[model samples]
Target: MRIGILGAGRMADALGTQWARAGHELMVSGRAPEKAAALAERIGPAARVGTFREAATFGDAVLLAIRDDGVQDVLAAAGAADGTLQGRVLVDCTNPVVPEKLTLKTAGGPSMAERVAAATRAHVVKAFNLCHEDVWRMTPPVFDGVKLAVPLCGDDPDALALVRTLVTGLGCEPIDGGALERAALLEATAAFMIGLWFSGANAQAVIPPLKYAFGAH
Candidate 1:
């Protein structure tokens, strides 16, 4: 698969390296041309650097790994290529959570993914927003002998499947998170988890086991 990543940051580097090792062609782009080139060099020969517009136009699927506030700018740069992102499967990995309080910046309006979907004709899927980028760097981020389950919210089945393949390539499982409208819930989950994590709380302990929660245990 040809994968284009919109940022040269940690999220882009971690995921791009994994996908590149899995034999996928990678195109990395960022606001800084040197950084993008450096990332591509580190990812090896199969990976290359390009402008935001070139990256956006170069792949079968595109990962928008830019910061929450930078998504619109990247999209604008990409859309300038052909005037639209129609027929593209866009993966959104941004979180609108504030740094200190870990509260959602988009508490009253559209979630980050929804805003991206609304801004373009691309089929947007929300995913990978609930964990730190370093978590993605793990060879297989399993804990307690369970592969991490990544929730994906999208309306397009094809786009979902494509992203699921990418998720599995990182040795993670992709769990259906229902329709696109549910993306806000995932963003909220990120904010909640981040708050708990930063507060030195065991966020996982807050959730009962599935069987117990279902009253079947």
Candidate 2:
């Protein structure tokens, strides 16, 4: 599979490098040519550098790994609003939250993932947003003998399948998180968990085990 990454930041580097190592062809692009080139070089021979538009056009699946505020501009530059991304699988790993406040930037409106879907008319999937980029950098991201579970929210089955494969490539499990409409929940969860993490709390411990979720029988 061919993957295109639309940012040269840590998220882009971590996910792109993992996918490249998994034998997927990758195109790394960014607003800065040097950054993109450097990232591509770091990813080794399985990856190459390209312009945003070129990268958008090059992949079967495109990862929109840019900052939330820059998403619109970058998508526009990639001709997404002009149909460059139509019918493609677009992965959204962005969290539209104000870190200090732990509040969503799109509080009363659509999720960042929804906005990306609207802007590009692509099969958008909300994923890889809950954890820090460093977590993604882990070779398999397992803990306590369990593979990390990645929740995915998307409307299209085929697109979700592709993303599930990508998730598995990193040795993680893919969790079906309902449809695109549920993405707002995931984004809000990110804000909530991030706040917990910032406060030195174990966010994962707050959730009950599956057997006790609805009370022990």
Candidate 3:
């Protein structure tokens, strides 16, 4: 699979490295050319660095690994070349939480994924916003006897399938999180989890077992 990543940060490094190791072709792009090149080199020989437009145009799927605030700018750059991102599956791995209070930055209007979808012609999928980058570094990302579950929300079936494949490639289970309109729930989940983590609270304990939380099945 050909994957284009739109950032040079930790999220980009972590996910890009894993995908590259899985034998996928990778192209990394960032605001800084040198930083993008550096990230591609760090991901090994299967990856290359290119301009945002080129990266967006080169992939079967594009992963937006940039900060929440910069997503629009990056997508704008990527789409500048004759609407390069049109009809592409754009996987958004961003959380719109403000660090200071762990509250959602876009608390009212639209979810980050919704905004992304509206900004471009790409099919936007919200995913990988639930955990830290280090968590993605764990081989298989399993705990106890269960594989970690990755929930994604998107409107496109094909785009969802593509993201599901990527999630499985990380050795995690892919959970259908409903339509793209529901992406705000995932963003809120991130905020809640992050707040718990920062407050030294065991967020996992807050959720009852499936039999209890969702009734006997």
Candidate 4:
């Protein structure tokens, strides 16, 4: 898949590294073309850097990776909210974190994904905004892999499926988190996750999942 990831920040770079490792071609773009280029080089030959407009047009499925406050601007820049996103599966990996507290600020609660979907009327899927990028990128004590679970929410069937497949490609299990509004729970969970960062070893995590699958041991 030729993925257009909009942003050159940590999350964008993380996605680029994993996608490139998964043998997918990527167009990495952001406000800084030079930073995007450096990110592309670091990710390897399968990924290339370009301008935001180019990335938006070049991607088969676009990953909107940016700060919550920045989402509106980035989407506007990409002309996404103007229906430029139709027929494309948009993976919106944004947690509505307020700049001040670094916690979610969207209240009266429809979730960030829902708001985004309502704005664009695009097939938007909520994914990958939880969890810390650096920890996930750590040098693991390896096995085949420690498959991390990532929950996704969206109403669009095709869009969800596409995102699920991409999640698999990124070495994570994509749990169907039901409709897009469910993202409210997921986003609110962002705060508990932030608290965890201070509690001990778990705080630096993303939408920390509470569910567990146990087997007879």
Tens digit of lDDT per residue, candidate 4, span 4-117? 888988988887788778778999988878888999989989998877767777766888888888877877887866567766777888878764575678878778888777
What TM-score against the true fold does each predicted structure earn? 0.96, 0.98, 0.96, 0.84
Regions of model 2 farther than 4 Å from truth: none
Clashes of each: 0, 0, 0, 4
lDDT of 2 by residue, 1-217 (tens): 9998899999999999999989999999999999999999999999999999999989789999988999999999999978999999999999998977999999899899999999999999999999999999999999999899999999999999999999999999999999998999999999999999999999989989788999889
Which residue pairs show collisions in model 1?
none
| Clashing residue pairs in candidate 2 (N, C-alpha, C atoms within 3 angstroms) | none
- Can you give the lDDT of residue 159 in candidate 1? 98
Model 2 score (lDDT): 0.95
Clashing pairs in 3: none
Better of 3 and 4 by lDDT: 3
- Runs with alpha carbons beyond 4 Å of true place in candidate 4: 99-103, 138-146, 201-217
Error of 1 at 145 (Å): 0.7
Highest-TM-score candidate: 2
Query: Model 1 misses residue 165 by how many Å?
Result: 0.5
Candidate 3: regions farther than 4 A off: 214-217
Best by lDDT: 2
